[model samples]
Target: MSEENLRAAADAVLSRLVGDAGGTARLRVDQWRAVEALVVERRRTLVVQRTGWGKSAVYFVATALLRERGSGPTVIVSPLLALMRNQIDAAERAGIRARTINSANPEEWEAVRLEVASGEVDVLLVSPERLNNPDFRDGVLPELAATTGLLVVDEAHCISDWGHDFRPDYRRLRTMLADLPPGVPVLATTATANARVTADVAEQLGTGGDTPDALVLRGPLERESLSLGVLRLPDAAHRLAWLDGHLNELPGSGIVYTLTVAAAEEVAAFLRQRGHAVAAYTGRTENADREAAEADLLDNRVKALVATSALGMGFDKPDLGFVVHLGSPSSPIAYYQQVGRAGRGVEHADVLLLPGPEDEAIWRYFASLAFPAEEQVRRTLEVLAASDRPLSLPALEPLVELRRSRLETMLKVLDVDGAVRRVRGGWVATGAPWSYDRERYDWVARQREAEQRAMKEYAATAECRMEFLRRQLDDEGAAPCGRCDNCAGPRFTPEVDPAALEAARGELGRPGVEVEPRRMWPTGLPSVGLELKGRIPPGEQAAPGRALGRLSDIGWGNRLRPLLEQGAPDGRVPDDVADAVVAVLADWAKGPGGWASGRPEAPARPVGVVTVASRTRPLLVRSLGERIAAVGRIPLLGTVEYSDDAVDARVPRSNSAQRLRALHGALTVPGTLAEAIAGGGPVLLVDDFTETGWTLAVAARLLRRAGAEAVMPLVLAVRG
Candidate 1:
């Protein structure tokens, strides 16, 4: 087909996709270029245009033209559920049949698969994770790959480890791409990709040379509809106050992006208290709840949905009016993608980022969750190689020292590298020779550090905010956006309502978080030197406890984290923080689930206090215990002692099995403290912080064995 014919076909489909807003919507020159490359030339392509540039239209239009030519269905590898839903709806608007198979809709998968096999579906949407499913990867994918007409990888930047939001599962697409039959045109699209990420993704899109080299349709990255700004508040509370005061003035319903799930919930709750109709959306939110939240936001029933990065991509509300960040993301690319969500459908949308002091701490914590050291990678491979059968994550977890989340991530990477394969039962070694990619991993780490610095510069830069972000993406055309805080002369002010500020302060200052005791022993504990498994013996368990806050909590947690930090100098607890702990204890005792609630289910009131031994902040721990004991009018039982080897045993980074093994004999209940505990009531077990809860669990067991009726653990902070 000629470019004229492609443009005509694309315009007709675009009319149906957009439906009568104007008589017939026409594709722009670049959108037509992407469509022409895919349909006429049948070339692989990558579209890196700004948000709202109709990248979807390029593929949907191509799918229509190709299907008119009797091509098989277009298979899209989408990243988020919300994205899939939006694309499916858009496909139907264009009169194209679309089906989806994602983690959320497993029940409909068989029906969708049957439709696909029968050639009844025009477009099939799936998550990147679905590409890694054992059955699908081994069974459905090959068949789907063979007969597919067009392959669309939405959010293609994820295919590159260098992308801001890279996922190990996404890289698995390379296999399918390599296997794709020649002449099956492929298209990858993203609104946010830097030069490095764009290069990597384009290279992969042209993998196996099934088609001509990728025709890259790179465009400027500037959202003129978005008016960007950064409001640097003094603290989390003041930021909340700013939102409470100014949210309604920011045009239409929008998203309030937060740095953490806890912060999202906290801000959502605070906003609701201020009488704003809002909901919190996070990765932790249930599928049904997330769906409802999305629906509410779409219909403008809520002013905003407090969200983390979970709501980043695939949410389509073209008329979204505003986006406020409680804290800035670590990367400018990531920030651009999120802020892109707004102003896509509207002429002008407010984009305000409230950068807090805690942003760096949050970034560092997430950075720590990336690829583990090579030693861990090597040991994981060796363990898999020695196994006779596939090992489930539970069984494999004990053999490796990585946490469950980290372990799963590592396994995904190994699967993509051909060093491992996930089968029906679990994961198995493929016996593939895999050289550790130390250089690649180090390079990615360095890139992340660079991105972090870039993000800091973004917040601090006096130049146009959008221009700053575009420059970070290596867009040579970047210039003054003329719509940012700096260029537009401060469209928003930092002044917050006094009443709202006080309310925010009160909400944040009020503190008490439940520390649910670990009930069952971690899986494969016996794989270590311990003989524990299944439900923990009730008598040996610690009672449900309390903490002043979680390290990620936007309230007291932000205040307490520094003092309880690992290497902080040993000093007595500050009077104000000590008072907060006392307040938490008071609330926990009298609260609904408290031992002092006088309910029949409540445990006997803690009769005394026993402080956990801490090597790093002994003074802080002892002082907190003394304060609690003095306030409660209970005896200050002696601090538990750590054996000589406890330091090595209490490795903070180890998994549950290794940590428990180290703690097994390293903790000793002082004979004197044990005597005090004998025949006693529930006692308050105090600690500066609990990372894995192993310390509290081990100490509680010893106290229980010694004769305490119950042990209630309390701490200044709970490490998230």
Candidate 2:
């Protein structure tokens, strides 16, 4: 390198990274190389370094240098709100003006865009999801792409479907990349990508087919300050007990990751009851609550933040002290990314995984929401192509069999592939030639299976855990890290205090999650030959009910899943579950809104037990209903049977409109059931499970019409 060029690069780093911090600034050789490539040569680059390795420093310094040379402001496509907040703060410290446009601050977007256009902003950070917004894509994005001096894609691994964290929004960056002017330097950075994901992203970076491929720079993946280990526990209660007893023994305040939102809330609540400060973080948490939780963790006001993957990706906590996983992640690359959050600035941090037998089942449940089948894809395309005008998501729900979330995900993928376009009001077909890449999707599925197997091996292996994770990422310099449990000796014991064990048992033994009834009928139901619209009739709507627990819960779910799984044989209800049902009923009676609640507004005790006939699991459903009625000394009313000729379209995974349509007139209350209902105070309608809740709604309406006072629906499990 020329001395003058080196001097300029050093100056950029000093001015931007070390300004007013009263410390000398020295660039790592690799960091300088990336800076030079972007600012000096204006070449595309990819940096695959571990967390806390100055990835942001490289980009901020490069932005400073490029702006000094009179190039347009740098545009960065970031992934998360937390990351964007961190970057905005860091940019201020570096003396570079930065503005952000994200979902949190929609009112500021226009002002930020105007600033960028007028060249008053030195750098602009955008969320990947904003790339395809109709207004932004058509208006602000094109101008920004044309004028940007440097383009940066943070968390670049997400751009490839093969990456552990695949996001359809990330792939939209290719369109922006193709529109950039020539010689506009690009930088893509991530800490978690195997060789395949790296190659896939690099190939996509050269989408215009003119510029050279992005230069790849990968460093060692080992974390010297981390001590990794796996502790095998017998069941969920034991794991919770371990956490309750030993949370304070860890190094400092950090994170405790759970596989499900239910588990996170339960763990956080349980720990708080045990006199430890904690809070839960999940996708379902409100934006304000999530922001508050993040801040509390950052300030060390809480012992830990119980969270899911929502806490991952670019959360800048340099001194985070420890990370514990309640269950194993499906992929080691993802595991590395999460644990990398710890030991970034601290001298030593503990990383532990409590692997349970239920991990595989949880993994399968999540993986089931994979890419849609080719038939669904083709059907969606046909529907879009035939429409005269754009159709909103609600318009398509009645025509498509997919659930809302799954449908939205499929549409986003198609949008990125050019087969569909998202406009102002709805989505429209682009009349573009598109075919199902069946082979590629199948390969990705196989790769996911392989990763699952690799994770299982990781939990069972006695070898160095850190080395195993590094090798999974195809790190060439992978070697045994002498700090992990297997490399040295076990650092954590599996034992839990007896009091803590009892506490976990008490928490798990408690049941009865309230099931809120659906009030308004889904939109566009008339499009499917149903006349239902607006709020459902108050007299016909089912009252709030109770379930033993959610199928995704870490407690009773451990027992209910095997019994309630699809195609499980028609066996009697298990003894434990029957006991839980008895307990839930007892608690429900005296509680608020219950039939036996002493309040004058409360309805009378349930007059009879009316079972919803199940084509599948009839034996179990009938057995449970008969058991409950027998215990409560109530009449066993006739079953609400679908007549011999009814069309039953009870798909477990369908949108509300389709579910309502399927159950609209397909079920009829038998004459004997109606006669019994006439004498009822309230009907206790029981079913095996409630997924969309339409079945319960329809059945409750039938009972109401049959002259029952009210319908209190109960179920064994609720699928969220």
Candidate 3:
């Protein structure tokens, strides 16, 4: 058919399906133009519009017109299962024949295929993964293609890994339809896109030539009705309290995204405990249970749903009032998708991101998981290159040794690693997998490194959160989103007073105040002296208490602990230190008080300390210490290990663990540790890493119960 004839047919179809025909018609005026353009344009095309932009109407109208003019059934591939169902339901509402093929039925697939082959179906909604299947493409698609009218790919942004919801399978649509007759014309649609997404669509559609004809319609991304808020809580209990309080005020339906399945369940249970009607879903949930949860959300039977990222796609409930991140998300892209669920069909929605330390760790872990080792990349490529066609499951098992359940995960990791591509038949190695070239690795590594930096940047960003998010998408010239966290953080800070700092420091530096290293295993630390030299004590031992004392005196207490792990029973001293052991111990013991406090303490663990007779039983405690008088303004450096037990009888534990426990206890109960004695008030708890805040909470409780007046927890690293 010539372009003139195609335009004429599209116009006729628009008139019959939408034009002044009786009741409500599907297509809008602009949709008619798009349909005509899609039919007549030789190159693949994109139609970018906001939600409710009559995109579906245009596709159907054009499809109906073409099918009536002897074109075959129009194949519409969708990423959303719910959207597909809705589309089919809408077709049924219009008295049009439509059917959906999914993983549910094997027997009926043949019938569906026959119907398409016999021209009994005009439109078929399928998933990208399903379309790429050989059985579907070979057995059904070929038959459907003979008379197929047109091809439509929805939620087209998913084809881009740069997209917020990238699906590797979406990239296969190009090859899946490779055998189709030329000029079938592919129509791609999406709600929002940056220049990257737009360019990605063009490239994937084979329309990347200069001055490509692509319709990039855009509307405001701002939702005025949405009130965004962010909170940086120290612990989950506090966060849970906040969640409970706000959940009561939130309207319509809401979603709570958690990083782990346990967290999802915990939040759901906590909400139920507080009398909020809530349900939970995660990757581990059975499909039936997942379906029920989704149905409840759609029917408004459940007021709230707590879930992981697994529950976001293929779901479309438009009246979501708000979305709350129980913890921080790994990236802004993920954050956007989870929060985007709200205000979908409504005028506005609210999103709250509650980050502490754990959320950051979650993102870091994900980054690590997604980044495949160079060897992993090479192995994946070797397997793909050795295969005749795209291989799946059992066929590729010997190569990757990946279990069926783990196959997709491994493939996805490789996908993000940019080592492989999803092709028409299966996965194919995209480029030479392993590169010793530092430049190439560095370039590829930057993609992920940049994203990780973005995660960190989001945490530290003081700019408008909305603008920051847009910048992350590489969208430039973005206007400030006035209703974000950055706009709100400034509302509460008071001016700093330098005089106050001076007064505070002067008052804190008191005599007889020393900040000792919080002993990790006070009761179980293994000890050695000249007395046990020939016995080779139950556990390896060479360092004497004098050596430890000397090291502690010289500000080496922190370093001495780790070295203790490698202690040998042989009394070996430096050749220059024939009689300097005493001086060394004393000097080591004199570490700087301020520096000692800054050191991170690992948690006290069950460890056996060796004695002359045997290894002592498992015991837990901070560094062993002998109660010393509050002596001199010369503050103690690291935690001094002292316990009532004799060095010969007690079992030793790791110093870091002991310090961690002490830190927890100090945070939980202030004015209890050596620091408090120096500071002259409440004690402070400190740790090196804090992800979920659970350990901190436990520490706080222990300290409080132990009669500490106040506990302040501090950590070096915190996640979302």
Candidate 4:
């Protein structure tokens, strides 16, 4: 087909698809104009809308416009499995022949390749990992090169190290397209991007030859129904208890964010003790498990979820009421992207943050994990350059002669450096281009340093948080996000649960037995693989502080510290605090607190604990599980279930009478969970972590219309 004639055919096909998306698919004037501009201008574009400002609409319109021009099939690269599935579903609903491919099933690659090459597909959604395949670059992409339409890179900020969620492979995308036929256009989109990431996209696309015109599309950040708030907790125990008490107050779906995988699991366990339906996700988990977690959250089968930075990338669940951060996030961009998942689907939402001083230490630890040493970076690049083809870690191990763990660390560092590529079965040398530009290597190093500095700044920012994010994401025209922590005062007020305190008061002197689970510190917790005998270690009182001290006295402090302070005390204790503590402990031990049932279920046996934390609402375990397994072709929801029997012991503690009195003293105020959910009042939905907005969708729908006027999400960070 002639180029001009082909372009026309592609355009026509896309228009037909757009028409099929229903009347609701029509883009607003501004959004339509943005899509037209990308097509007509042939330059880089940045679309920064609020959670639901028709960002997808802009991309869909752009996709149609490009496809109609007879450019063959357009490639839409996204980070989320849910996004790919949903986008494909939307395209099909709109009558577009949309197909997607990923690493989930190597067996299906041939069929997908044929579909792409035969031009039987209008659009193809793929993961960056999939694109790194030599067969992909040399096999399918070239088929449509002569007529390939628009290459839409979603979440484009991932290209920059400075981006909130940096994906090392994203930098290699431009390289993969280096051989594409002329006239093929690229459209990059992101809800959030810092100046550096936006510029990187432009530079990679060679847009406007160093003077690409960037567009700013703004939507209302002022969500009246979404009240923003922050919670400053002194310890983990009180934070957790507070979380348990407030879980039901959340509208429907929510997220709780923690700093580490261990923290995610710990927070989830504490919540499960109260009979909350929760699931967890982390990078360490198998893709199958993540798929299940995503499914549960989407179907609303699981009410809560705990996870690290891995849950939100491409997942989309719009009915969230709140997103909560259990600790401080690493950067403003990360925080913004994570919480942006809330208040989606035209419902009210909340973003909340609960930061402790230790948050800084936690962030630093994360930084140390990703920040590679120069020697490691250089060695990784050298090995990959020496190999003619992709190599797995085992194949390259002898080349480096480093310990397996150390080599893996170097590979991770290299992956972040964009110097390495992770193929389906092996790693490849993607950095030969880096060798030609030593300065680029230096730039990578310097950019990493700058990112660390930015992380520090984000953690310590005193200005309006929304403003900080706007600047970071290159939304220079963005005004103060009047809804965030920096623009508004603290939303989390110092309050207590009167009913809980009253209960505490009456139970404090009841002479209830204490279990290790209720201890101030979870000391002598059995290590993984140990059998549970329902035994408490000797000399360990089940009091919160003493237990913690004992755990710290031993080598188990790191594991117990965060769990103890999951929720800070509300300050309303009864006269017989001791009795209340014992009563609470006893209830927990006998009921939901059994070690076998204390944790939530997972697809596989728990190798260790994993966490899912968010800021706005309670975690969305069911929805997250559904999406993770939804990869391109799988229907994992309702097919998989989880078991929390991995937990070995339940820590129990006696509530001292004095403690009960203190708790009682602080919880007499109004606006408790009951009050907020009753009559017209504010109801805060809290979670441990939130990456994408999906986790908070349910809560937003349930609480926004009830007398609860507002839903807020406070999270530690947002993954890119």
lDDT, residue 314, model 3: 43
Worst 10 residues of 4 by lDDT: 545-554
How does model 2 fare in lDDT? 0.90
For candidate 4, write residues 1-720 as lDDT tens digits.
454553444444445545643333334666665666666665455665555565666666566666665657777888877678778867875456787788776787788778877878888888876655557866665664556677778888787655667765576576545655554556667766655665666666663334444554444443344545666654555466566677677767777777677567656765665588987777766888887887888777877667777765556777766778777676666777777877776456777777655565555444545444456557667867877777776555434434345565456545544667676667876753543345654675566556546655755577765555556655646565666566677655545465543432222222222111222312111221123223333222111111111111111223223433335322212223323333332343344433235555211111111112222222332233222223212232121111232221111121122122222212211233233344543222322333223223223333333334433332222221
TM-score, each model?
Answer: 0.98, 0.98, 0.59, 0.62
**How well does candidate 2 match the true structure in TM-score terms?**
0.98
The worst-scoring run of ten residues by lDDT in candidate 2 lies at 15-24
Best by lDDT: 2
- Of 2 and 3, the candidate ahead on TM-score is 2
Q: What ranking of all candidate models by TM-score puts the best one first?
A: 2, 1, 4, 3
What candidate 1 gets wrong by more than 4 Å, as runs, is 1-3, 21-23, 644-647
Model 2 stretches with alpha carbons more than 4 Å out: 1-20
Compose the digit string of candidate 3's lDDT tens values, residues 1-720.
765676555555544443335443434456656776666563356776544455676787677666666777778888755577667765554445777777645577778877877779888878777755657756676666655678888888888766656676676675545555666667888765666677878676763334344554444444454556666654555566667666766778888888877567756876786678889988778767877888888888888889988766546666788888877666665565567668767876777777754554445445544434456446657878876678654445434422333456557545545666555656877664444344644554466566667766776777777777666654556677677757744321122234433432222211111212221222211221111112322122111122222111111221222233223232222222222222322332343322133334321210111111112211111112101111112222222122334233121121222233333322222333334333232233433223334344444344334433433343222321
- lDDT for 43 (candidate 2): 89
Give one digit per residue, the lDDT tens place, for model 2 in 267-363: 8999999999999999889989988998998999999999999998878888899999998899999999999999898889999999877788888
Model 1 lDDT, full chain set: 0.89
